[model samples]
Target: MKVLVVEDSDRLRRSLGDGLTKSGFSVDLAADGHEALAFIRTYDYDVVVLDLMLPGQSGLEVLRQARDEGRDLHVLVLSARDQVADRIRGLEMGADDYLIKPFDFGELVARLRALVRRRYACKNPRLRVGRVEVDTAARCALRDGEPVHLTPGEYAVLELLVRRSGTVLSQDQILDSLHGGEYAVSSNVVQVLISSLR
Candidate 1:
């Protein structure tokens, strides 16, 4: 999975980036809302971890613009404000989930996983398609009740397919979902991953 962590606090941003990287996500960091908007415009992220208080532009503004432009990326708002009204407003502004600051890292990861599953219209964390089962939280796949080892690229492609199971995803969309602007990917890489999965 790829995620964007948008926070004004340098320390918290770095901590979340490192922890999320270790937890198996490609992460991008933005100090404030403007930087985040730039990333959002240029790349495709599975989710955005946005902080409400920001310089240049506020997080809510970022969320609003992204939604207005029809960007369907999942957004999880992180704010120090824990008030009920604030939470409601964030959700109303198109945030998939809201997390207060000083939250447990584990909880954040868990919530992100849930959002990813939701994006795929997967109500169950353990997704089963035919005899293939994928544990989204564990980042592992099982085939015929036996574990199937998958390279990161292959797993990423599979995840994307599972997320949009009933639809046909062109190669460009698969590439977008796999890597952001920071990393260069060959056009045929998506095909390679799909062939490998087959």
Candidate 2:
């Protein structure tokens, strides 16, 4: 899945991006609300890790604009604001989930996964399309009862397909969701991944 991390702290942004990428997610980083807004408008992100206290536009404004524009993407507010009012406000503004800073990396990843699943309206963790079954929480796939060893990128692609089984996703859609508008995606890359999966 594609994740946009909107954080003001350089270290936190890098850490979250690197970790999420390692865990089989395509992640993009935006230091403030402007960059985050630009990315949000230009690309399709499954979720955005937003911080409330930004340099220019606050995260709330960004969230409000996204909702007003009818973008159906998930927003996970990751802020230092841990108070009841802040959390309620974020959710009230259409954030899908909220996590406090000084948070556990594992928990953040888990939450993001859950949010994506919810976006797809997938209730089960085990998503099965024919004999190709995906254990989303475990982040593994089984083809005909055999485990498939895949690279991080390959797994990300497969997971997206498995989630949207029986549907057609264009190369642009795949690229937009997987790379978060960073890479110049070619048809060859998507072809290669599909071939590899087969």
Indicate which candidate wins on TM-score.
Answer: 2
Can you tell me which runs of candidate 2 are displaced by over 4 Å?
122-198
User: Model 2 over residues 107-137: C-alpha lDDT tens digits?
Assistant: 9999998988787665577888898888877
Q: List TM-scores for all candidates, in order.
A: 0.69, 0.70
Ten contiguous residues minimizing lDDT sum, candidate 1? 178-187
Q: Would you give me the overall lDDT of model 1?
A: 0.86
Clashing pairs in 2: none
- Report the Cα lDDT for candidate 2: 0.86
In candidate 1 the C-alpha lDDT for residue 107 amounts to 98
